[model samples]
Target: MAYSIINCLQAAQDGVDIICLSITPNRRPSGIATFFNPIDMALLSAVKAGIFVVQAAGNTGPSPMSMSSFSPWIFTVGATSHDRVYSNSLCLGNNVTIPGVGLAPGTYENTMFKLIHARHALNKNTTVTDDMYIGECQDASKFSQDLVQGNLLICSYSVRFVLGLSTIQQALETAMNLSAVGVVFSMDLFVTAFQLNPVPMKMPGIIIPSANDSKILLQYYNSSLQIDGDSNKIVKFGAVASIGGGLEANYNNEAPKVVYYSARGPDPEDSLPHEADIMKPNLVAPGNFIWAAWSSVATDSVEFLGENFAMMSGTSMAAPHVAGLAALIKQQFPNFSPAAIGSALSTTASLYDNNGRPIMAQRSYPSIDQNLSPATPFDMGSGFVNATAALNPGLLFDSSYDDYMSFLCGINGSTPTVLNYTGQNCWTYNSTLYGPDLNLPSITIARLNQSRVVQRIIQNIAGNETYNVGWSAPYGTSMKVSPNYFSLASGERLVLSVIFNVTNNSSAASYGRIGLYGNQGHVVNIPVAVIFKIL
Candidate 1:
């Protein structure tokens, strides 16, 4: 691994502009921490060589404490749904609506009914009442027996409420417990629920109307038997595509709206322990129920079940959409640094929701609709990422490899060890304290005494305009530029290489700067800082 890191660093130094490190692989713990480990050494070498690393925030979720590698240097991203709804299916008016059963205790009325029936029948002599606690179940078999005896069952729709089990599995378990010939559920809780026929039960499992469930439960308590016309009144609802269909309500089937499952945040209010200081999900993108590339043999899909390339929800899916967009920006602005690119993307995002109102931060229950004042830093870093705006940002900042190195070593003033970069190849240095030699944390770049090589590639837009490139190093170091003067024909490309030699041993830990000066006073500045071994 150490040797691989060295080789990778050399390649980067030789002008490999972007390196994507998949910190984690499916079915295994992420390798992200390895990159942060002091023992790895290669990570530091990479920073010294100057590389931008983007990482996934990890898939662990539904908990307040779960985090990815949680390092300041790495850009961590979480998942969100592409759109709010799942697959669209036509629901005939006569079709049964299954009120999801066995859901969490605080589930909607429709869900509560199914839970009551499932629990009552399984428990035999025990009668289910409206106030029965659904969360108290510890035995699936005992619950199943109760469900078999009762004509109805209720369950929660969310994975966390269901205790990490699939809804279908829970339904089947309920059916087996109850010896009843059929089942009924409510639709108020889950808009995405589907009906599966031949549900592997001696009795048929079906969803009913929420109104019907309420009526029957009220009458059953008052009279204790079947309510007339309950079974015949259930109907299925059709799926509608809302957002990505285009700015208008007209369904396009091409683009959908952002999904509800995506994680949202107001920037962290207080940097308390166990909480993030930075607000995330800077912008929303396609995530909910999105169909995308997947492992060839993975069984995560609903239709193919175990087949590769399936539809999934969560911010995880939304993150890659932005990553792909970032790739596009790099292609357009070859000279832009990663930090600049981040800035352009963040600053040019969209702020309004489909309904034209500002986005809200409320995330749960009846009070979930309360709206808070919106701030660019709070609701969104800038706005939802706009690829076009990023591609043609009016003003661009260019950063060289050295600037990033200073950032990694924590010598950068006042800013956290991890810095947020935006603009066109531009690196922005932020600090909490102000003043020269400011007690603020500062990032400084330095050169090593030994021979070092660095390469950079600058892509020309429109394949037009001939330009000349030059370089300079900080006062204490000397560098030799290869092909010091090169012509980049309109719609052409140029690659430059620079070799440096440090003045002395002290320079090994000294931070300095490097500049790439071009025509029209276009300049890219890079800070070079060396890592200090505390021991």
Candidate 2:
């Protein structure tokens, strides 16, 4: 499937300035046994053909080496949270408030409505069983209008809702038909854990996602109930509640954090347990709960079934953000190469968010508490992208088609291997280059021996200016850059030799960055990560 798409892209490469491949196949093996993926090689072909490629780092994340976009030539993107989020609350008649998620307007702050559970409002002759959708409010005909009218209807979050057999949209329709003022979804006690993203609601609503919280709501409802003492357990409902406005977005101070599901980096390499020098996710972009256009006929989001737009999340969405930014950069610099554009984005990215705090990443999966740690180069590449900064990146780390070919050759990719994917013979170019010599904006040394020398050549695309180099050395490692300060004119390039020396042996990886502070208010940042082994 990917091969076919690549073929089509190759055919249309001339007209295409940027290609955002937002899909990923099942992960391939990582080691010397496999030289290159056919899809990756095809993407390289597109890059060499002057088409910039942006890829989504796969969604299977919060784990190490789980990235599916590992190629150095492709500008891979990961997901991060933006600064805005809709937060709603459920205020009970007893003055107890529970936090929840719902994207809908709220009733007046003091306007409390009579509340009734769905089961308590069932039709006298309804044939639906409790095991079905009776309490889910999927069928208005099965509910009594007199019992639900002018009331906030409480519905059950059952297995049917989990399996996609029942949806909040259906419940909403039933609520509207029954003349209910609002709706509340009580979490099922049987389902131990469930994560609910915000759902779009036309009317006021609140979804209690925690089982314990649902139990408290149910207990409150039972307390206000007038039971008939019959075997059927009939009830005259009397609970009251109000819905808080959720449509108003709250500003998240700690935003641009690498989401829990966003794929991490340290690209896999030719040797088992050893990663590549390239970063997997080249940068991070807003991907969580992004409101985007949706096809009304699409069934991907039940909440937006008939709506023209929906809130979506994933690396696929994140990749398009980068693709759009790349388009902007390409428009400003029509002559910019694919490598130059990517370099501009990475070098100008923000390691800190708008709040002036270091960007963080979710370190654990299913994090109810949302445990986070400072994000590393592996977590968010350079960082969340800064659109304004990217357009005027003072310098760019540029590479050519031949440079990529040499990288392929460095992996000992044979002529037949190169020919199979790129249709280029390995003998046509210099094949002795090392993987670490790819001149990328970011540096990663998967296996750092005691001492190593790496070099970078950056071109000044802006006015003539003097740049003073500053660096933070990785833990247990010392770094020295020759000619700490230099001046360059527009369109001129300078070579920098960086020497790395190990001060102590450590088993884990460490990270740092090299910053070039220009006199003209231009800053270029290069992220560096080094992995250490016992000496």
Candidate 3:
């Protein structure tokens, strides 16, 4: 991993403006004490080289502190659903339509085929007793070809499938082997709720996840069943269903939402027991049901075996969206530093959705019952990225190479350690600086003992503009910014001090924002996060 990071850094040094890492090499380490591994140190080197870096926050989420990208210098991104979706429906012969998910072509429109469960079509010759092999259809040879041919095979969705023991590919192959026209996956009854990611299918398919819907399908199938009266009941398949094409994209007016699997954070850790005074997932972007380029040889998904395009979802996908926008910023502002570019994106991000309501985050695991609430700094660092606003952000909080090195020093990074990674000795600065003192677009004081004063520097880049500063204090605290209103000409910089006083000693983190409304139609927002802890 370290070697790969070095290769990427070498590319950046060779003039790559932006680097998007959709891959997470170390996702288990939660705290800052164990954060800066060799891979992280390598990324720090990349950031120091004046390259803008964006990394995925990781997919193991809705779990706090479950982030892999922990460096304060690296811009992390989380996933969000952008109002577009692909829906598939199953129409039973009885005219009951049930919504489901899958990426595959449908069978002949309105053409119903016989429906038979995997258990009902078992071959008399095989002796396999495992539920996965029988009901889950892991093995095609265990099912009779004569019984399944020209029918819609009903396969069971199991926990094994979630654990990678069983796969949709296996089920699709089983259906093909049995000459079935289409496939239907019934949700696992025991494990009522689990995230069922859409899988690519060459054949017509649908996964019914709702318990009520699955019960309806089951009841309908049973009613259509014909049993010959004998000492042993012989079954005749009568249930029929038509699969709808799910490949069509549907765009709606729905607001973009932080996805369930996108990792959340209150940063991570500073060194030991204290949390890092940094906002992770610098922002959120479109990542759900994204249609992107795919490698033809990649065996990641069976449905896209030789296809050049596929629909996928993850924080990995979200990072690229930010990386692309960063490239645009670089093109427009050739003199902009990495920190300036980052600030542009952060300060101009939108906290509200198209509906004018606060953006929401998926607080629970993926299930039919979607649990959501308003997102916070920890859930969505600044907010959703706004490309147009970012291109014209009037003011930016810029940091330099020395500024980052000082941040390392403030985090208790030793002089020799800093030299080893960045080839810079912290002793040269001969000053005291804390991690929270860095002039970042956002402010986070993980541990506020009584109170602390943090400083920030903002440079006017758009025009000579007068601005009125406004702020909402974080819960349990009171804050006041020095010189509430100030005017700056182009290329002029001003220093501001924020004084925070603890009103309530609460361990829970508080969130707020500072708004800089300018007369030149420029608005910059800085997010504030802190925890008021009494000694």
Candidate 4:
């Protein structure tokens, strides 16, 4: 991972316009560095050297505190879906259809196969846990070859302490080992409520939720029932499923709707004093059902992709869209700093969808039921990216180099000389900084006391624009903007303070936005993220 990061940094140093990272660590990594090493510093240098870095907010999400790429310099992108839904026929004998996502490009002869349950076959004598049954599937040797062979095995897979991908792999591998036609996976509850990663499998398979299809399996399967009469009776537990057709290449695949798997934030990489919690997943993009060009030489194509184009999904797909936009923005403004381009994207993005509603996000986990709530900055930073609006953003919360330095001071809360980096002398210059007060497009307050006030400066980039302040108040909080109405001529800047005071309330996270709308059709939206508690 260090070597790869270094290689990318070197490419940026060699003048690469945009850098995109679709890959993530094999394991969940903690800390912002792999040893506070110089390679990590290289990432900082690359972004500081005017290269726009776009990173994937790893697919392990809908879980708070699971977000990656916390660097403010890097544009962290999340996965979202457009409404052009894909349909694959996967119906049970009882005529119940379960939702699944796949595109095989050719129709298969739908056939009924005997359904074998791994748990029933492996542990008939002794009662075992779900993990033990999962182990039987994960370790193919644990299951009886006579029982599993030539049948469609039903396996229970759960996310214990890691991403669900591993469990999916285990279930599929078990079927492959036994010469089984296919495997039906019952996904255990995860933070992501409803997720469908359209990967090509060896034979063919579908992941059904334990809460849904698994119940259907138990209800219809005669093998799961006991003998009530002289003869044991069995109900039909067969399925007819056909996997074909990838998401078509079209521009109308609607998006900006959060995927259950897209990483949400209150970033967990708290390496400095005040850096414990910052807004992330800076923007969402069309990640699911993405029909992207594929390489014929790719090895995973046979198992997880298509021949010409593939329907790949993840933050991996989302980051590239933002990176491509950054490349265009760089071409439009040759001298624009990376930070400036980031501000443009954030300030110009729309927080609302075409339905005139706040963007919908599913953020739930464990015993919590999935709830589609209006997304806030924490769910989707500044909202979805708008390349057209970003190109000529009328106003920008342009963060200068010093502004970032102040941000570091805010994070470290230590004397600048303590770290001993060049031009970072907090002791010798203006040092005190607030995390949210750093002139960035969005805001995040890790710990909002009884009342907290932060200042923001918006620079007018468009000619002679007057603006009005419009905002959403956080739950249990009253918001006040001093001098809400204002005007800014070209090349002018204005400072405004947003005050968030705790009203009669309990304790939790609060999310809202402060919008600056101009008369000349210019709009700047800044998200406000706060974790308010009694002081």
Candidate number that wins on TM-score, 1 or 2: 2
Task: Give the alpha carbon lDDT tens digit for every residue of 70-178 in model 3.
Answer: 5677888998888778888899989999988898799997588999988888888764464435788888888899999999999988777766778888899999999
RMSD of 1: 14.8
Range of the 10 consecutive residues with the lowest summed lDDT in candidate 3: 266-275
Provide backbone clash counts, one per model.
89, 0, 0, 6
- Model 1, stretches more than 4 Å misplaced? 1-52, 56-84, 87-116, 120-167, 173-283, 293-304, 307-311, 365-367, 370-376, 408-535
After the best TM-score superposition of candidate 4, give how far the Cα of residue 157 lies from its true spot, in angstroms.
Answer: 8.3
lDDT of 1 by residue, 187-271 (tens): 3343332221111122333333243343443334334333347664213212111101111122323222322223332112212
lDDT of each: 0.38, 0.83, 0.82, 0.66
lDDT of 4 by residue, 1-535 (tens): 5686668668876899788888654334444332123333455567666777788888887867567556576678887777665544345555566654444232345555666666655534334564554533776766667667777777665654134345555566777888776766655544234455565555667655335555665466543445436454323334433333333333453346787778777542333425434578788877876778788667563434236666777889888899899889889888778788888888888767766676787665322225667776766788888889989898776665565555555544344332543334665445666667677788787766789888877777779988899988877788988779998889898888888888855546677778888899988888877767675
Q: Quote model 4's TM-score.
A: 0.75
Best by lDDT: 2
List candidate 3 segments past 4 Å from native.
28-32, 91-97, 107-112, 127-132, 138-141, 159-167, 189-197, 209-230, 267-275
Q: Each prediction's TM-score against the native?
A: 0.46, 0.90, 0.91, 0.75
240-334, model 2: which lDDT tens digit per residue? 88999689889965788888888787543335332457776889999888888889888876767888877777888899999999999999999
Worst 10 residues of 4 by lDDT: 31-40
